[model samples]
Target chain A: MSVTVIIAILVVAFLAGMDGILDEWEFQQPLVACTLIGWLLGDVTTGVLFGGSLQMITIGWMNIGAAVAPDTALAAVGAAIWVCGPAHLTVAEGLAIAIPLALIGQGLTVIVRRLVVKLVHYAERSVRQGNLNVITRVHLLSLTLQGLRVVIPTALILLVPTTLMQTFKAGLPHNVVMGLAVAGGLLAVVGYAIVVNMMATKWLWPFFILGVVLAAITALNMIALGLIGLALAIIYVQLQSQTRPPSGPDDEMDELDRELEDL
Target chain B: MTSANNQMPKTLTRPDLFRLFWRSSFEQGSWNYERMQNLGFVYVMMPAIKRLYDTPEDQRAAVLRHLGFFNTMPYMQSTITGVVANMEVQRANGSQLDDQAINNVKVGMMGPLAGVGDPIWWGTFRPVLAAFAAGLAQGKASLIGPLLFFFGWNIARLTFRWQSQKVGYSLGVTITTKTGNLLPKLTQGASILGMFVMGAVIPRWTSIEMPTVIARVHAHDQLEQLTLQNVCDRILPGLVPVLLTLICLWLIRKRVNPIWLMLGILVLSIFGYSIGLLGVK
Candidate 1:
């Protein structure tokens, strides 16, 4: 890769890292991160394709309550580099690499979050001393560390000789490649399962079954299926509201819903 | 509860509210396990605290109050920030709301909001939307897929943050009493949508196919062929995908690390493919 391209990839990695913790702009998600990296590498197709596949695999990886899911920033950016850069790996190989990276990234994230405790303490002390700028400075500095978490790994990965990656790819057995692809195909199941674990209730299983059966039997694209889902969700909510008696005046959830509706 | 400071601005100005909204987006910038967004909360509240509390002691107290443990879904923190901002304004205007009262509201709201927000945004909305966009990306090899997700998510998120903050501010102390069935109801609605989409994506997105010929039968003087994949499709088109999803769900419920599950899947796929029990067309 050219110097400019390498610099751009690092920049993308940095953004992905910052967004990993921030989780605000979603630059960490493979869909965006890979696409940007791929665009930087001059192969948008491979980048996007890898991103699309990786997105499904990581879709259900969520931070619910206090539990942190695996890290996507490093996984997405690192995988995209291999697939879209001089490594010339296939998307499936890229995915195979991404999974382990995600695990490692998850570990890194916990460590970083732990270390940031000291920074928070420092910020607290600064506040006690009445220096408000330390709050912003410490926060921004911590965010930069998050960006580096991915960038440093990515920089190291880029430092690996491109020919070595080619040699590694060439040495893989055909069955291994095929198996990796098969694994890739089946990997999205894990993400789906996580979502199911989170959202599934006895009452909700039927919608899932209905969705499966409909998609299996019909030629409906995802957009069409999604529209049907939206319609059904709205219908179900409406019927539910009509049948269920309002809880007494303390029903804050209903008020919150009404508040949401006004928005 | 009358105060001596009738001269102080009793409410945050529009500029102050905007500053709060803008800063709220970075609420997790300093996330740490020790306090879990305590500093982030302080960071977000700094602008409002500066605007409302003129005295050094009151400002110090306000900062100290928010520095306590505070964590929730990142997006949902906006509502808490709004409510807290309102309380700060009242306290500054001579209301009897103590630091404990402020902390009480923070603790009280974070749990419920996190419960609702995590599933709605992270669980339901994001997965559902990303599934669709990924499909588009893979099916068409188009830039629109990622673009759609990027814009779609941010638009909804930004709007939610803005509106929720406003509503929380306007509701103020009333929000404490306003809690009701909305939690289960919204959660149920999101679950319904989420489950349905998940089911749909299994068949549409997951690509497990058993292309290996499991058996061959010749009953009518002519050769007959049967593939395990064909049998599976005859039974149910997405049976393998569904079964795999269920197994993963079970294992996840059993507390197996997802990384291990993924590594297991890799091994299983290689083995299955090598043994001709699984194949890709």
Candidate 2:
């Protein structure tokens, strides 16, 4: 990789790191994250293809309440490097690598979040001291740590020279490679099931069934279905609200639809 | 209520609002299980709090007030931040308000705003555009996917956040009266759409197939073998994937750890593929 490529990846990684925590910019989403890396690697097209596929597999991932979801940022960058770099792996192969990367990112995220507790403790002191500058610095430092979480791992991955990556790719058996491809496809099932588990209510099972049946029979596509969903959702909301009993209004739930998306 | 002009003793300048808007993006910087987004919320309010409360005691109290537990979607955060900042100004100016009122606003807003934001952003708009973009990328228009998604999502989201802050600030407490009817309906509609989209994708994203032949049968003109997956497709186009998903759901319900389940699926895939029972479509 050229210095330009490596530096670009680091900068993107740094931004993604911060964005991952903020959950804004969505620089962490595979679609965007991988594309940025792909663009830097001079293969914006492949980066996008990989990112989009990867995004579907991770579509249901989210951080609900306090639980951290698997890290899409790590999955995107690591998988992008493998797919777009010297290895030139297929999207399925890149996705296979994303599963473990997600886990690793999750663990690292937990640790980083925990480590920032110390910063919070220090922030209390700055608050007491009436030192606005210190208060600002503490927050900035915490943001830096978040950025480094993605950058450090990404930098390390790029440091592996091209020949090593080529040799690494050459060594894997064809069957093993095929198995990983199969694994990647099935992993997507896991992702969807996870979403179903969180979002599906007993009353909502019909909707799930409805979607499956329609998809099975028609080529009407997701966009068309999405439009139908929008119409039905609007209608359902109006009807349900009108029918609902006028009781004291507090639907406090540690939502039974509990699932974590970001690491 | 926002201390906008009439009272005019002080104001949150455009620079301060800009700073706060950008700074508020860091609300999850130190997310901890204990307090969630509490510290970040305090961090965001610091500028406004410091500007409003000149006395050290009042400043420290203001900071302490905001450090309580807070959690909400980042998109909807500026609304609460703006409202609280406005209310905090009122309190600083000797309005007959207590910290509890600000706390009430924060707590009250987090739930409904989140209830609204998640379904729309996470569930509906995001999935719709992303899946569309992903589909495009998978086809020949690969470059368009990420560019459309990034620019499209950020444009809507950034504008909404900025506008929401301004609206929330301008309306003050009355923001509640206007939004009470709107939020619940928007949330319900979005969630419904989200659920529907999720359903549509089940057949597309989830993959399951049975490669083994279940039986041999005489066809109209030739000998034929029936595959298990063929039977499933005849019965239901996505039965295998749906069944697989349900089984995974049951495993999750049974408290089988998700990581272990993921590993199990990993092993199952490798074994199935090695034995010629599973392959990518």
Candidate 3:
């Protein structure tokens, strides 16, 4: 890869890490990470496209409280950078490497968070002393640490011997690779099941099944599919609202609907 | 009025603006203190801090501190624009810029804008681009795919930054009046677009086909032949993909982790390939 491209990738990784630490929701997700990495690697479009595909597969995935989803930021960013970078790997191949990279990324995040806790204490002292400069420095320090989390790993991956890497990849039997792909597909289904169970209501199952069927059969685009699904969801919500006993205020009902809508 | 009114105006320069923009853009990645300092120093301050020597120390410090917090590029742009506008109005009205107010505005807007902008920019837009690129990858249009990806994303990013800054400036008077209800509607629209592209692209990009078996029935003096496709059509048309999907569903319902599931599938595929159970052409 060109030195400029490598620098760009490193910058993107650093930014992605910052996004995660800042809790900029989308930044931590694959969409932005992949796009930025892709753009820097001279293929923004592919980066965005791959990022989006991975986004859907992990649509219902979230890091609620302590439960960590696969580190999509790493997967998306790493995949794009590797595929669109000097590596020139196909999306599938890039993803094959990227997925494991995401798991490793998650480990890095855990370590960063643990380290950040100590910094927060330092910030508390700065705040008590009325040292706004120190407080600001502490914030900067935290963000830098987060950026390093991504930069260090990505640099290492890029720096590794390509021939050695190829041999390592080749050493895995064909069955193993295919089996992993199948397993990934299956796990995606499991992720969907979690969402389905969370949104359980007798009437919605039909719509859910209908969605699966439609997705399986017709070659309708996601936009068309989403509109259909959204329309159905809205109708279902309205009907359910009407049939229910009037036991609450309008605001309360709205809140309940909003909560349900989120699911 | 007697002493404060006689103070010289704090003249802002181009470098001040550049510093602000640079800081905002670099801060886009700040998740913690270390990242903020490193990125802030390298990407933000290093470019503009030298210019600060010509300005008043307090103003310089204020500007530096303002750029310190966690921010995304667009969010940072919007927040900085908002603060600048606020300062301009204060200057015009014969009052010094309220440091707390500027900080409040910066901190206040970053969260919501980041919340909305991040997902819309990354989750929705990027994926649509990836879907197209995946098709290109399949076609071996290698260079074209990546080029298209970059063009689409930068256009979106730059547009968002400009639009957000405009909104921040124009609506500074009653910023709260700007509602985010519009976001969900926009996201809904984008989601539809995103999914459509994914559906069209995934099959082409990924290996999702299955092998089929055929059985024939023959009479004493007659023989019959049937193709795998014909047999499949007879017993539930388009069964293979559906069967694959259903199998995925079954595995999902069992609450297995994706990593383990992936490992399982890889093993199964290799086994099937070796045994010739899954015919590989």
Candidate 4:
């Protein structure tokens, strides 16, 4: 890789790392991260394809409450570098590398969050000294640490020679390559399951079943299916509101009860 | 400490609210296992605290008041910030609310908001949008998919954050009481769409091809070959994918770690391929 391209990749890695925790700009998402890395490497097509496939697998990997999901930032950057760079690995190999990297990234993220407690303590001391500026400084510093989390690993990955990576790819058995491709095709199921588990309830099964049945027909594309889903959701909610009387605080309790029952 | 009665009514101008909105984006910058977003929350509230308090003692107290544990869905915390900003304004202007009262409000609102916010924003809306974007990108090989998702999500997110902060500020405490039912309703609607789309996506996105030949049949004196996929299709199309998803969901419910699950899938797929039970599409 050229010096300028390497710098650009590091920058992308930093942003992805920071956004991993910020969850604000979503730069860490594979769709955006891989696409940027792809563009930087002069292979937009492979980058985007890799990104979209990775996005599907990582779609349900979300941080809900305090439970952080596996890291997509490292997965995307690392895998995109291997797949789109001089190594020229296939998407299947990229998938294999990305999954394990996600686990490593998740571990690093947890460690970083734990270490940030020290920084928070510094902010606390600063608060005691009545210097409010230190609080912002501490917070930004912690964010920088997050950005470095991805950048450090990416830098390490980039240090490996391209020929070594090609040799590594060449050494893989044929069955293993075929197996990884099969795994690649099957991996999205895990993501789908997580998403379905998050939203599934007794009342909503029909919609899911309908979606599955409708999706079997080739006529319905994603856009058409999305519109159908949206319409049904709106209509269902509307009918529900109209049928139910105006709810007071008592009804709020009943709503909670219903929500619990649904769960 | 009781010298605030001489001060006139303190209000947060648009610029102040704007600052809060901008700063709220970094709410999780200092997320820690202990006290979770405490420092970050303090950071976001600094602008409001600086603008509302005059006395150093009061500013210190205000800063200390928010130093306790605070965490929630990062985006939804904007509403809490707005409501707290309103309370701070009132307290600065000599409202009888104690420090404990403000912390109570923060604690009271975080859980419920996190509950609603996670399922809607994190679970439902984002995955749905990503599925469409990925489908566009993967199928058509278009650049618009990532750009569409990046811009689409942020636009909706920023608009929600800005508008909800303003509304929460304006509505203040009443929002908690009034929104008791509304949040669940919104979640319900979003989940409905989420479920439907996920169902459709499962059949389309997950590619489980069991092309291994399992049987031979004789019909009308002609030999016929039957693959596992053929039998599966005869029973139900997309059967393997649906079953695999259900098994994973069941395992997840049983508290199986997802990382293990992915690794297991990897091993199983490799084994299946070696045995000629699974094939690449």
Q: Give the candidate number with the greatest DockQ.
A: 1
Better of 2 and 3 by TM-score: 2
TM-score of each: 0.94, 0.89, 0.59, 0.94
Worst 10 residues of 1 chain A by lDDT: A243-252
Q: What TM-score does prediction 4 earn?
A: 0.94
Write one digit per residue (lDDT tens) for candidate 2, span B6-78. 5657668888887788877677887866667878888777778778876788888888778778889877899
lDDT of 1 by residue, A1-263 (tens): 78999898899999998988999999999999999999999999988888999999999999775688999999999989889988899999999999989988989888899999999888888878987778879988988888899999999999989999999999999889999999998999899989899888788888999998989857687778888887888899878777666644435687989999999
Local accuracy by lDDT, each model: 0.88, 0.78, 0.53, 0.90
Query: What TM-scores does chain A show, candidate by candidate in order?
Result: 0.91, 0.88, 0.76, 0.92
Off by over 4 Å in 2: A244-263, B1-7, B54-57, B207-209, B213-226
What is the C-alpha local distance difference test score of candidate 2?
0.78
Estimate how well candidate 3 is docked, as a DockQ score.
Answer: 0.15
Q: How would you encode candidate 1's per-residue C-alpha lDDT over B38-91 as one tens digit per residue? A: 988988888998888777877887888889999899999998888888888878
Candidate 4, residues A1-263: lDDT per residue as tens digits? 78999999999999999999999999999999999999999999999999999998898899877889999999999999999999999998999899989998999999999999988888778778878788889999999999999999999999989999999999998888999989887889889888888888899999999888888888888889989999998999888876776645567888999999999
| Residues A137-220, model 2: lDDT tens digits | 777787888889889998888877768867877897777777777766566566666666666667777777777777775768
**Which one wins by DockQ: 2 or 3?**
2
Model 1 residue B235 lDDT score: 90
- Provide C-alpha RMSD values for all models, in order: 3.8, 7.2, 9.1, 4.9
- With candidate 3 superimposed using the best TM-score fit, by how many Å does residue A147's alpha carbon deviate from the native? 4.9
If the candidates were sorted by their TM-score against the true structure, best first, what order would they fall in? 1, 4, 2, 3
| Interface C-alpha root-mean-square deviation, candidates in order | 1.0, 2.0, 7.2, 1.1
Worst 10 residues of 3 chain B by lDDT: B35-44
CA error at residue B57 for candidate 2, angstroms: 4.7
> Per lDDT, what order, best first?
4, 1, 2, 3
